[model samples]
Target chain A: MKVLNEMSVNFESRSVNEAFARTAAAAFAAQLDPTVAELNEIRTAVSEAVTNCVVHAYRDTIGIISMNIRIAEGNILIVKIRDRGCGIEDIPRAMEPLFTTSPEDERAGLGFAVMQSFTDKLTVRSKPGKGTTVTLEKRLSPRLSDV
Target chain B: MLLKPKTMFDGKVLTVYLSGDIDHHSARRIREYTDALIGELKPVRLLLNYSAVSFMDSSGIGLIMGRYRMMKLYGGSVSVVSIPPALRKMMELSGLGCLDVLEGGNEENESA
Candidate 1:
């Protein structure tokens, strides 16, 4: 994939950063001239991934959350959200719908599911004590007029 | 994190107008605000107006589910209205359609 544009951002693991991350990524993705729905889909997927970092990864203690966005050939948008916090011990169980480690927190455990549904491809890699990285990619099909 | 949930009471129906995105941060405040109202007023029907909600992730699902459970304890029902299509899809995919009444437009309850 030939990268046309790319940018990376690092922010604190605060809940407020959730919106910031999503908006920043969306603005960067705007270069591809995606439609409103496509832009929203990208934003929503980024929101879920970033929220997971703020809520589950850091878990009260402040940490660093980084996000990288890259626009590749064919208007393919790639997003990577990474955090150096307590990693997931059970990846399979964590990805299961309605399976939340912090059920008491009222989490529906639908983060992964939402990401999967919004993006074309989703990948999660984590080390128990190291951190977790979520990679999401979506090919934004240009509007009929643009094509 | 702009979670300014405005509540209007009309007899048995309590309508809350939720604005901004519903993420982990704002969800806590929203939960607190609505839960306090539900605890005090105990309305028979709780209506959540999401017309102004621009973005909502899975945390929105948690908020809805939590409110649903809370309302259920008091034998009340929860309904979401004016949900944007983007959010409607999220709610639908999360199985929230089965948990609460989802309607179009922002019509005030005539029955109150």
Candidate 2:
């Protein structure tokens, strides 16, 4: 897909940045003229991804979390969040609903599930001790005006 | 930023009014404070008011599930009220509806 627009950002994996990252993703996605519901879905998906970096990836210490957002042809919004912290040993198990490693922290283990449900496509790639990258893609509905 | 919750207790019900965005960071504070109140008041019902919540992700679900478990341990019940449309969708996707904690409309009611 041809990238019409793109932006990249790197921030510390702090819990506070979770809100910032999601809001930033929504702002960047506004160029696609997504409806309120669409924008919210994007924001929610981004929040879950960033939160994983803060809570699980860099569990012991703070690390840099990188995000790349691109608006492609056909009003497709693609968001990629990556962390160079401890990678997931089991991607499938991690994505399973209600499966959380940190239950004591009150994690519902619904992050990946939420991301998958809110976005059209969700991709997760990780290698233990290497890193983890989560990509979310959504095709915004065509506006009547555009048609 | 973590916005403190406004809580009220009426003998049998402990109502917590949660506001602002509930992400991982804010959820921690809300959970701790709400749990402390639940432990102290030990009400028969725990009402979580989300009318003022502007945004929430899975962390909010965790908060509700934790509270549900906590209340169940004491034989109490947990109910979520005034959930926004976006948040209601999130709750449904997370299968929180089965718990039967979701109640009432999106607008904050005077009775609550």
Q: What are the candidates' individual DockQ scores?
A: 0.84, 0.89
Docking class of 1: high
Kindly list the per-residue Cα lDDT of model 1 for residues A1-147, writing each as its tens digit: 899889999999888888899999999998888888888888889988988888799997999999999999888999999999999999989999888878888999899998999999999999998999999999998656555
Off by over 4 Å in 2: A144-147, B106-112
Docking class of 2: high
lDDT tens string, model 2, B1-112? Answer: 2657888888999989999899998999999899899888899999898888889999999999999999999999999998877787898887888888988575445344
Extract clashing residue pairs from model 2: none
Worst 10 residues of 1 chain B by lDDT: B103-112
